[model samples]
Target chain A: MNSQDAILPIAIPLAGAGVAMLLRGWPKAQRLWTFGILMASLAMCANLLNHVFSSGKPLVFQLGGWAAPFGISIVVDALSAIMIVMVQFVMLMGCIYALDAKDIAKRYSVFMPLFLTLTVGLTGVMLTGDTFNLFVFMELIVISAAALTAMSDDRSGTEAAFKYFYISQLATIFLLLANGLIYMSYGTLNMADLAIRIKTDALAGGPMPPMFTLAMVCFFATFMIKCAAFPFHFWQPDFHAAAPTAVSAMLSSVVVKSGVYGFIRMTTLLFEPFAPQLQQVLMLIGAIGVIYGGFSAFGTHHAKRMFAYSTLAQIGFMLMGIGWGGTLGIAAAIVFMVNHALIKSAMLMLSGYLASKAQIKSASFENIKGLGKYLPQSGVLFFIGSMALAGLPPLNGFVSKMMVFRAGIEAEQWAWLAAIGLASLLTLIYTMRAFQWVWFVPPAAGVKAKKDGDSLFAPTMLILACVVLGIWGESLVSIAMQASEWVQQPAAYIAAVNPAK
Target chain B: MDIIISFAIAVLFATGIYQLLRRNVVRSALGLVIISNAINLFLLAIGAYDGTVQSYAKAIGVRSDALPLALILTAIVISMGGFAFTFAMLYIVMRRYKTADIDAITELKN
Candidate 1:
């Protein structure tokens, strides 16, 4: 891709963000501005997706016409295009949901700009040829997340945001440190350049330095925190439950995926240096996260908190595919990642509607009873979303879940496959319980207002999206497969790194 | 030069651990800022501080290491934004609940 094309998708949102930030006081006008920005993003992403689908190779653009390795470059391969597409879809839905909110104008004004900036950062991370630029974008996303999380004036919101900010900042530092070490060793932060140097020099004589292992370990830890894996997930429930619904969707969908994206990019591009061990470590962590998150979700009563725990479990399934280390497994992982992003964002939005009707933002199971009778549409929407999350057959979730399980079997990891099944069952238990209590059980008479304003407007769209995605998942899977092909063949990425070749 | 890096890491680690263990939200946030700085220093050191100019010196028959500098500069700005966020959080907590201790404010349920 030429610099003009590569720069537009990133620049359009960034310029929008600049304008939105400047126009903060006019909350009423902010929605129009955000709508415009999201539409532009959607268009650009669609154009990029079309271009890639027609053209078999990845699009490479060196900024300012500078050559790779010496100067910064951006490459939009299949994975980049797919991720951009997913971000654009969820973000568009998020803006629509926010626009329906009445008192949230000021919040929307602040959030829209940050949201745009975060998009630029995430897309930039995925497309950038340089590893160090990945760090820059990652920081942008992290900082924006911190600000977004704390934007809520509530007690739990601020507290959760602070915890998330602290741990994530620590994770960023570790990432930066790892990037520095890799640069010191290779003298270039371009991933393809590093791969080539590692291939040529290490293949000839020298033992692969311990630096490779340490750097991978540091990188692993950083992403593990970002993904909210089993041990480092203390902040997940708090942040997910405390933040506003739209923000929660962003956290679950785009922000968390940033970490998974990093792990996939690193393992695919840099794993050759320490190939075998990295895969093994990833598999071990993935398997553990699967079991741990599922079982933990089983015990949670709060609606959104349970969903947060479930998010960790789903991430586990995606990571398992990457760890299994083959074209098929990686493809399965990519499909699952995209599927989760769609469904989970929708689930958060629906949860918001349920909370608003109850006149309490709390998502406790007991508080959710008989909402189905009062608001039939949101109740049904939540049920469908819950089913998709449980990996029920024919839904998008089931297909991706099946792919991950198949990948495990293909790799001959029978025990992990069993764990995956057990996790699926656990998912069913929690999601069914949440659905039953929220939709079926009768609420205590006169506890609160049973009906409310059109708060369900935003959440309903998310539910509609979830249903459509569940029914028509094959189209998404096909795109994921195309992305997997590019990931499997690193030539496009390599060309971006070493254009002379 | 090495001492500077070590001191920064030590201070950051100490402050981070202290704040992490505290009940006060503001203190914890301050500790996070300190730790983020330490991490940036460590990254700068690992990227190789040539004890001269920070750049790769591309103009003087030598190229400045733009990659590390760009990343660190970005990191610095991000931390500053985070710092501002922490202050905002503190203000919210103070205004709403009149408490800076995270444990004291428990209105929102999990």
Candidate 2:
């Protein structure tokens, strides 16, 4: 497909969002429109993937038919295609789970459009090949996500939305500043053109300019903040745990992954000049985040808060894997990301059900008890998701975690690898403790477990997806591995970025 | 001129960080405004350097950099929207939680 076709997937949903808002009073219209947008996005992603692997070339779409270094362009390569598929798949699951909820149905008119807009922004971020365009896409995604978080309008949701929005704005400014530094240095905003220009002008001749390094550092810093890396993770706990569970799932699973996506794209395509040291720094941060987040999760009493911290720990593992900087490492990161998206979303859904059904506002271990007897289906699904999250053998998380650990060992980054392994143990302990308290122990004195079984189906479907994916993870891993191979070999991607050459 | 923009950004970032660490909402929101403006200025400064005109009479084959200008405009709009959001949030927090102090608004406390 041409660039015209490439831009349509994102544009269609974005346009549909506006249209849905106009039709806010019609529930069926909202569902049809939003689902149509998502379906179109999925089709576009699949088509993009087909073009990427089979052709082994980058697909470049110059907006308004303008050439690069003048007009902004969007580029989709293997890595972008992979991310598009992963994000779309997760959103599809989220939409399905959401559609089934009665409360969600009530809010469908407003929620669908906002969610679609977020999807458009995320897809745009993955595909755009321009520095300034990346910031534009980031702003779009962040704004929509904040709007969605606040859609529920509860105090907690509003609070979480506020925090997420503020911190995200800070990160966006960092991103904008970095883009500015690069443009100042290179006089070009297209990423592919910037890469070539920077390489030829800056890297080839005299000592690499201090400004280049400064820009690199700023870019890395912004991405770290966006990914909620350790030391800049202050916003995540409250934001992730307090938002409605579906939003929590999307935020934890896919939204933050965009940061990792940017890092992977930048490191592979442009920052390869300093790959070794950059990888080392990323790995160090990831290792520290893993250990820190795991312990914090272990210490937390609130269930959602505990899992929120656990997400940081899991993201640490993904970043660490990516830091290894090879086909296997990047593939490992992708696989782990897909698995986390599945399991984490499922777990949060279960948590939401518990909150709605049992009036358990705190999500403390003591607040939930005898769930196995009261809501056996949700209990079992949650247990499976929890076990998967903790990297239990034969479960999905274990498969991907093992791949990442193996990549670490292959890269001979043994210390961080060991840290990850140790973090897994902490993860196991905290996870089991949660399971024991929520599902096994008797209810605390007075609170009664809701006996109605109507609400368990959404979480059950989510868990079923996790199980199926776990059982057939190899197929997805194979596709991911191929995509990673394309990313690692950047000549094709570089060509796509500067197709005029 | 570059140095001035850089210095301004540094100050904005530092102030934003400091206010972000504080326990008040309005102050942090104001700090965010400063930071957002600083970033927008930084982007615009980068796009417009010494000896350049903002507009182009398009000689079709001739290349010029106007994309950054467009981006800056977009950034301006986005930051303005964010500013409005922060102000509205401040209003709601003051009314509902009875304070704009983040520390005092811990209704969702763990």
Candidate 3:
């Protein structure tokens, strides 16, 4: 495939968002247009992934024909390609579920356009090879996602949106400061160029400026807040809980992955010399997130809130895997990231579906108690999703979790391993407890189920993916290995971006 | 010049943080705006001023970098959009709750 094709995934959604906005007068046309755009982008991503893997090189597109280190470069390596495909796939599912959920469709005329814009932002974030471009794309994501969250039917949605918007701005400000610091010291905003400069400087035995470490700290704090790790996770549960069901699924599944992506890019590409040290810190913070998120999730009674806390815990698991800091460890983290994205999105959508069927249209246990009995299909789906989330056998979560466990063992990180084990036990306890309460508990008096006609196709498709990936997980593991190897050795990525060097 | 710019940035940051910690939602929003401006100034300072030449005119002598100007402009635009959205949301929130106090806006809980 041509290197120019790399921009299609980002450009298509962006242009399509404009078109979707115009078609807003016709909801039917808007839905079709949005769906068509997502499918086209997904195809483009798949094609790009195939090209990158087959050629064994990153696909680099220099914007406006300007060379790297001077102009914007859009690079699609194996890791970025994998992440793009996963995110677009999840977005497509969320769109499908949103279309089927009548309340959202009826209330929000701008949903389709906003959703398309969000995809554009996400794809741009995944593709951009420049730090400044990453910041720009991140802003795009924050704006669209905050708007989507504000459009939730719940009155609390606006409050959640405000909180999300304000906190995200704070994070981005830190990011901007970090970017400025990097540019000041290295004289380049292009990631590949910065990587080369840092490497060369280290080889020359030069002392790094203290500003560099401060920049790293800023980067660390920005991503941790974005990732909703411990101590910075206060905004997540309320934000996720207040968002619309499909939006909630998207937020928990792929949106938060942007933070994880930043960490990966930082540790793997920008600050390679500092990785070993950062990995230890990441492990410590991740372990704390695991315990805190798990216990908080168990303590919560709201369905969406519980899942949000669980998201914190799952992100912690991926962080610990990343902290293991070898080819195997990064691969396991990739596996876990992909698996958790699918399983968590499915669980969120299922919860949304059940909430839609309830009289009060809330995911709180009090409103949704015994509601699953009326929707046995969703009940089965939720069971599979929960089991998968808890890393049960014959599910994708189990395979990824096993990989993470293996990575920890190989790394000989016994203390972190114990933390992971305890977190796993906690995950099991919380998920099963929520499962029992929702599916088995008797309905409290005066709680009645509504005759909602929302389709279960979205969550079902995701759950089916979980089962399929679980059964045939070797392929995913191999792909994760390939991606991780590309990540570990940045030479190819740097060369692809700056061929002249 | 470096000391002056650093002092300015420090002062702006302190004021921004103070406003940000206020109980009033509007003040906090304005705090964000102030902080963003401070960051923009910091970006400018990081470029290390060279007043010998203009950005538009490139001479054989020392030329000042224009990239920081571009970066600051971008930051200004983004922060402006963010503030506009934040104010609009605050207006809605205020109208709904009839208060600008953040502590009173407690609709969402665990």
Candidate 4:
């Protein structure tokens, strides 16, 4: 294995975060440092993706050259590589987006450090093979996110961060307890080793203890909050809406995704036997989240909070996709994960861009009126994202939504199909209502029209990518299928981490 | 002895949860600390091979599993850091808003 490929996705950002903070006195240097680091990480992910795909197997690197199930192991499979690529790409854009925001750069010296730490934590989450290590990285993520949330200059930012921090702490406790239970039962913390033992037990006709199910339940409860599904989704709107625009892009696009990623990891790799039952429960909650988020989106006139609710709804679709339970169904879920990251991040950034330009301070529906005619570029970007999210034809959102429909039909789940259909209607309503209110409504007098510049680069590139994905839907679908293969076939992942019998 | 330790853990966890659900930010921070200790106890009790013996034993038969001890050590350090961060944030939140009640701290438009 190329050890650099296994390690640099995390190490580079960690090293850069230190350098960025040291050079905090120089904002320009910080920007350059952040951009260079993200680009390097992106490039590394590209190389690793090529290596993994060409080798036609996952790559495992045991830290300190220790054997599996003993020392820490970092596994870079198709799914991990894909997620790294997505994260690095968005982070690179977030850096550029942050450059234009200027508010963050001027006020906070720790932005680059916190951003890099967040990146490191997330990268660690994707790569680690040990559940304990996953917990460690998760704590790192929570701390970094909490600090960043508090970094927001507004009182709302503090409040939102406070809420997020507590919820995360509660999740952390659950995860730790689950880890204890699993460790006590299995005698080893390595995921592949656990999977091997589980298989061995099943083959030997041994029964799973009730404790196993209880542990799984605890783990599931944690990720549900992470996914912000259903009842646990209340904190999402306030947190996302209060963050700095670029931070919102990161949070909405990839940070929240760690939860969904955790759920997928548990179901496929560690807890497959209980998945059917858990996924059914997830399916019901997902439907509730979908409808709840959609209905809640209509109640908010602020662009950011509306999108936050919409994200809750999108998560429902992804969960429902996972719940559909087949190769195509899981693949569809992965595809939507990718598309939502792209489309939603772009939408959130566009709102921030518009907010900066508006006469009103925030992206409220009332203040940002006439932007469709006045600021045609942002209006267009917002419209495209809105249409895609609302599942319009010829958009990337429609592509993934189509796959979800296909997955539902193939699984013979008419109820899921009908639920998705209803959610789609609600999505169209909120998105269009927001769009119509922004562009078609008359502007208040004395609104200062701001000109678009290099700042437009972030949303434009993002929207273009979404459009490209839509037009080349076939390629995206096939790639998603390959990634989901990592989750669909547990043996592939297990074999990569533990090659020896 | 085992049952007692387990009951104690439950009580600590319950108190932590209750304190967290309180309206004040300081109570929330205190709850965090309390919960951290509860988690440590939970891991310790779960790792115990014998409730009758002392936690550390060099003698082979009476020895406790060392893994949870190491894990607890790491968790303690991490939780300390977590507590420091939380307390510092709490101070800042209090100073900035001039209030400890979280309900009164609602300024962000949702």
Candidate 5:
């Protein structure tokens, strides 16, 4: 649990990606190499999580042997550790599931390279302790995502990529504006350093300049848009629906969490002092996201599009949960992140598989039907995913959703509670309709159902994971509580990154 | 000088947003280019450039901070890559769809 261990998560995938680029002519070799790299990385993530949990402290790694505040550091507390493990886990599953998604894998020789780079960027965002570095990582993510979105052969893929590119650039512009203001005020870009300086400056009886609040507002708005929250969420649906199925899985499941990760990290590191006031705002945004995403999703018919909107609704729930503003709220948000990442990746991959095997190569329930009889096991797994998404009882989603409800109640936000309740009902209705369309109905006139081999492994593992999270909910809850505590109180975080201090 | 530069940055930003809201993909891409330049200018302004110093003096007291210059250099390189990528896509989109308007690229719409 030290700085050296911190680099492993980023390095493995990056090196693998470089090697993958070299092996571009041989798809088989490329796939094998990337899979091995991801598995090794997953194991390393597990080891890091175990080590951190046992040590019960944060791991700090300063680059090039420099002092923390003087140099960039990678800090992994419980929260970061869990997110790392979760991100790596989903990515590993995605790699396996994507073997059959040949349209994307075979088309772009740089696909795996870009995929590894995306993972590196995500890990960087989660683990880095510098604001400017966060900007750099955000750029990496945007560039890779835009390229991947455009990699698909469909004409609309280019358009979707462009749309996402411009919108995300707007968000990045706001982020840079905030970072410039912060550097101007504090003369430091290290997050922990800023936290300490801001606090000490406040304690010396100098109220923060109004400019600081404006900078934080910039960070807030940018991260909210990145989260694809209610008002600025229009960019995600097209990108998610149009990307190749494997990329769609990654975009819907793991990529969007970078925004949530940034919001949580920035809040814990920079805005804990303003949590009480900010909590209400967070709840309000979360609630709006829930209802709007829910009702809108209810009207969507295409399978991937439906899932994309559902993801919107799910993020809304996550925001409301975290906005409740305490150990429970933060823990619930963390749980929601983990659960959504698992279920959505599986669901997207499954839909991709079904649609690819069908005659029409589309995910509209209109194009393919009776998927249940052709792939009964997949149908059951899909049902599990839908049920979990809708927060059906005795499932993983239920546990997190219930925690969110309890957290909302504790915060005494009856309106948030009511909105969330209605959102949940909307989710159930749409999800069930989706389930009926895919699994229960007779085959579409021209549809043909063929099950593919080894494609089921990833979804099965992910669905099993959902079950484990439910049956073993206590462990997740306890870990989430500990993680939330570590996040809420940033003293250890600051100290770990700047141990010499 | 600072006031002038700030005013110009504001104008650049205004123009960028206007272009970004255009219906044509090519124009929107042009908007992105303008906005990126404005962003670089804002970063430079935040560094509080000291114009009195001679540009070639290596050991001057009034020189501006070098960090924003480095940052702008990096930002320029990165944005060039991004813009190049977007423009290539724009070309492909134009050739494939025979139009530059995003509204007409509706094959994926529900």
Candidate 6:
């Protein structure tokens, strides 16, 4: 594959969004166009992953034929390639699910364009090798996501979008400020260049500049907010619950992973010198998030809100894995992220299906009560998703959770290990509570299930993915292990991006 | 000049945050705009300010660092787009709720 193939994942969706907007009058054509574009992007990403794994090198494409430090570079290493593939796959599934959703289809004209734009942003975030470029793509994500959130059928959707917009804007501003400070201190926006400078500076035993530490703090705050870790998690539950189900699925799955991606990049590449200190902070926050998110999820009565809290809990686990900060820990974190994306998104979509079958189109416990009997396929799918999420054996979540537990044990983090175990118990409780309430519980008096002819293909396909990955867990675990190794050692990454050096 | 710019940035940040904490949604939105501008100014202040030669000119003497300016411009454009959408959303929210008070618009909860 050509080095320029790095840009195809981003470029395809971007150009497709414009073409889709033009085909707005023809919804079928627009859907086909968007799907084709996503498929093409996915193909490119898979090809990139194949190329990176086979070549054993990161692919770096410097725009305008300029060298890395002077120009914008698109770098696709194992980690980026894996992230791109995971995101594109989840996006494709969510797109398929959206097709069968009538409420979403009603706003298809606007939804398709925004959805494609969102793909463009996400792909860009995954591909960009520069910090400023990351900030720009993140803004693209925020704009499209906020717009899509506003399009939700829920009455609170607009309000949720409003809250999401302002908070995200504030977060990105911190990112921008951090970028400026980084440039001012190191005289480079290129991450590879920054890493080299920081490494050399730390090696020289010079006093670390206060400004750089402040910048690091800012970067940390921005990503923490983006991932919705404990204290910064207020905006997430409201936003996720009120978003249209398909959008909610995407937000919970891929969008938030961007934050995790940023954190990984920071610890593994940009700020390796500071990793020891940062890892401690991350572990503390992760423990709190695990406990807080788990209990909150159990406390919530609304199905989507409960799932949103569950997302918080899941992210907490990933954060813990990342905080463990070794080849084992990072690999475990990556696995957890991938598995949770599939499990949570599928569960969210299944809840959406349940909501669609209700008299009132809401996923509230009362509205969706006993509605699962009407859709046995969704009931089964939800069961699989819940089991996967609760870390049952023979499922993807079990493999990832086991990896995390092993890593904690290896690190001898007993307190965090206990927290993870407690949260796992809570996960089982809330997930089972939701499942029984929706699928097995008897309907309330005078509440009848709507007999809609929605297809169960999308969520079912996603659950099948969880099952397959769980059973065939070795391949993904190996791949994640490889990605984590590459992340831990930034030498190959720096060399690839700055070949001239 | 650096001191003055830093002071201005600080003041702008304080004012923006003050507005942001207001109960009124419109004020909060405006506050976000102010904070964004403050950040932009902060970016400008961080760039090399000693150069007499313009960045576009090729000179033996020190040329001004143009990257931060470019970054600020990008930040401005992005913030503008976000603010436009935020204001529009705020308008829709205000219309639906019949009040701009954030406390009054409490449909979504734990």
Best by DockQ: 6
Ranking of all candidate structures by their DockQ, best first: 6, 3, 5, 2, 4, 1
**Candidate 1 lDDT, tens digit per residue, A277-394?**
7778778888888899988888987877888988999888888998997877888988888888888988887777677667655566677666666777776777777888888866
**Better model by TM-score, 3 or 4?**
3
Residue A237 in model 4: shift from native, Å?
0.3
When 1 and 4 are scored with TM-score, the better candidate is: 4
TM-score-better candidate, 1 vs 2 = 2
User: Candidate 6, which segments miss by more than 4 Å at Cα?
Assistant: B54-62
How do the residues B9-70 of candidate 3 rate in per-residue lDDT, one tens digit apiece?
99999999999999999999999999998999999998746767864575766667888888
Off by over 4 Å in 4: A202-207, A451-454, B1-4, B48-63
Question: What does candidate 3's lDDT look like per residue over A121-204, in tens digits?
Answer: 888888999999888888889999999999988887899999999999999998999999988888889999999999888778
Candidate 4 RMSD to the real structure:
2.6
User: Any runs in candidate 2 off by more than 4 Å, and if so which?
Assistant: A102-108, A201-205, A360-362, A451-454, B1-23, B48-67
Docking class of 3: high
What candidate 3 gets wrong by more than 4 Å, as runs, is: B48-60
Error of 3 at A165 (Å): 0.4
Give the DockQ-based CAPRI class for model 1. Answer: medium
Comparing candidate 2 with candidate 3, which one achieves the higher lDDT? 3
- Model 5: residues >4 Å from true position, as ranges? A203-207, A450-454, B51-64
lDDT of each: 0.76, 0.78, 0.90, 0.82, 0.83, 0.89
Candidate 4: global Cα-lDDT? 0.82
Chain A TM-scores of all predicted models = 0.95, 0.94, 0.98, 0.96, 0.96, 0.98
Candidate 2 residues A1-501, lDDT tens each? Answer: 565777766887889889989988887778777877788879888888888778767788878878876777877777788788878877876776666554432464678887888888888888888878788889888888887777552456777788788888888887888887787777777777767766676456677655778889888987887788888887888887776666777888888888888788777777776778888888888888899999999988777788889888988998898899798999999888888888887787777677666654445565666554566667778778888998876688888988998898889987777778888789888888887877778766676765442256656766787787788878888988988988887767767666676
Proportion of the native interface contacts kept in model 3: 0.76
- TM-scores vs. true structure, each candidate: 0.91, 0.92, 0.98, 0.95, 0.95, 0.98
